[model samples]
Target chain A: MVARITFESVHAGQQLPRLDVPITASLIVAGAIATSDFSLVHHDKAHAQAAGTPDIFMNILTSNGLVQRFVHDWAGPGARIKGLKMRLGAPNFPGDAMQLSGTVTAKEVIGQDRIVEVAVSGKNRLGEHVTATVRLALP
Target chain B: MSGTEKNNWLEKVRAMVGREALPPQTAADPVNLPMIRRWCEAMGESDPKYLDGTAAPPAMLFVWTMGHFRAGPGREGGTLLGLDLVEAAGFTSVVATNVEEEYLRELRCGDVLTQRITLDAISEEKKTGLGVGHFVTYRYEFSDQKGEVVGRTLFRVLKFRPPAKTNETAARVDTDTAGVTQPLHPRPAITRDGAFFWEGLNQRKLLVRKCGSCGRLHHPPGPMCPDCNSLEWTTQQCSGRGRIHSFVVVHQPQIPGFQYPLPVALVDLEEGVRIVANLRDIAPGKVRINMPVEVEFVEVGKDFVIPAFRERQAG
Candidate 1:
């Protein structure tokens, strides 16, 4: 069984562990396969450049999943994702390293669950790539 | 002889303890335009650039792989799980709380595209009035024909079930909303060329552009067939019915000043035309996959109307 944690156990303004994830061609390819999104911008570099993009931009879907993974791994299996909102900033290219970091914003008790909101962001070697608001529900 | 004997012994031990190899997760296929175009048309996209290759819109890229899992063998090998896992775990419904996308490049026809997908995270939380729910996150990377990267998208889906006590309250709310239901709206006044389409919608029917040269059904009401560039065409009325191929309930609005808690669906009509429209008459929570629906015209404003769907009554 997974261990349970509460809202009162953690402090507000606490920063979670940072995650260093490598972005690879294979990782991008696998994401496309799973999502069934086959826009040329994700696969063809020449096409992307021709269309005025610096490089292939990472799918917003994949970035959200990455943020979720980073927080879930830290919060353990018991943490439940309630809501997440993010804005696309810089484009993520293959062969770049993405560093994900987050800070706890607030905590409160709603019904039988304890909820925590985390402000998260993903940056690459080129600087900030994406940022979002995450709400997690804990026991 | 002794050195050979030692190497053989090491090989035997390695064979006994099988190496753990990570499963292969790579997309190797072309982005089928026919499939995507069908989805765009079904979603009520009327852009000629999407059909003409003149200028493709950004959102049309989302339809690149609509129902791709069911397309062919070996294609669905990967674990492409969506927000539906919560439903399998007994959740009543799932909604998209938010979605943000950026277009790195425009996709054109004949561009072979590839995608990579991974599960980012799944977390649960309690709602003040709706009870507990889980949010699932997924990441996607898109590539084009020449093995060059293009763009990426991140999506989050929120799945939830009604609390035992809240079920009754939800049903009551649904009933109250349905009580004030109004009739289908009238069609808008369109010009000479676009008149036939509006007329068809007023009659509760779907129309497609039939190409003269290719004899294929074209959508988005184009003047010339993209395949042959022939301008000759005719309109065909189709049954205003289809199955819910895929759908999402919007808990958060994409545009400001819009209403919330709307169920939007991608319907695959019987005439082989797919369009996106708002699902009506049924309770938001009761919407399901493969739900039979019939099209109805709803007037949004003066001289403007849209096609909507209502759940077909069971036999």
Candidate 2:
């Protein structure tokens, strides 16, 4: 079981803990599969290279998932995601590492529910790969 | 290699259009909870909708249609959609370039699915960093038990001949491109002490080693026993009954002799010894901890039989 973070304990302008993901070929391949992005660019190296990329890279869906996980892992099982949107930039290829960082941007109270909006960014050596805003409801 | 040969090659390929790329096939396992659960767990999706196991994720359409390895044929060891014909003509390496899909109905547990793929289009010769090749596209349609279309996908691939290189840096395989009769399974490393174990597989039996001093049974047929330090040992025929202790679905480093997302398991035998082998007659999503299984000998290629495990029906 996972521990939960109460709405009262979270504050705007607070920084969440950082997570570094080692972008191995296996992780890239498995992450794409877990998200149901059954494209060759995310799994087959020869295919990716022929298509212009150097090797298999993380798919946008997997990036969205990695962000969702970053938020939930910080907010805990008690947290529920209300909305999530992202913009992808650099391609996260194998042999690179992604540093996922986030900050609480705002908080609100609606009836018995407390809604929190978090701004998240995942970066690699090339640059930022994904920038997103995650809105979650905390207990 | 000559002008007339080049023209005839494309003519042969052109005739395959609107034809079945490979023989019609069915999903190895029906849409079920275990596979759905595994995907959810890996993606960190804890939604009650999926946890309750009613509806499968819409994204699993292609995965559900992934085929199993069938010994012998035009496919690259039962994969690749008869692309050997393309490879034989000179385009040996392939890369998927694009895909578009549409979903018509939701897939649920107990729904068995089948697929039909047709070669839809082929492009003229193009030059690139990799080499000169053509862009081949196929249309895939998936149907359910009632023969209603559930989903469709347009898949495109760029098949090219690898760029030429000098001897000092060349690593390309010769484009012999025969009908892919290569062995489809990796051979077990037979050794002096482990010879009996493989020999048992030849005779369709499972063997465990018993320590002559204390009667302790062990797996892998080692020369010495860990429990009693006994140099003496003998063989015991096993019942081949077991339960899955642990397992994994391997997807990386794409070994040629096997399929991707291969399911391998550590099976705890009823005789109290554990052995590792591949799983058969089931999908990766169907494997579970403590589930009952039995040993099965499958001949994956010419005289290349390997020991694998299959689900044992509960009594």
Q: Whose TM-score is greatest here?
A: 2
Residue-by-residue lDDT tens digits, candidate 1, B196-219: 676677565677777777888766
Give Cα distance to truth, residue B136, candidate 2, Å.
1.0
Candidate 1 displacement at residue B147 in angstroms: 41
Task: Residues A1-139, candidate 1: write the lDDT tens digits.
Answer: 1344567677788888888878776666555444455666566766554443334556654565567666765676456666566765545667578888999999988787688988898887555777887777766
Worst 10 residues of 1 chain B by lDDT: B166-175
Candidate 1, superposed: residue stretches over 4 Å from native: A1-5, B1-315
Q: Write the per-residue lDDT of candidate 2 for residues B75-143, one digit (tens) a residue.
A: 222444446767888887765555555556657898888888898988878875346888898888999
Best by lDDT: 2
Off by over 4 Å in 2: A1-22, A29-92, A97-139, B44-46, B69-82, B166-315
Shift in Å, residue B74, candidate 1: 19
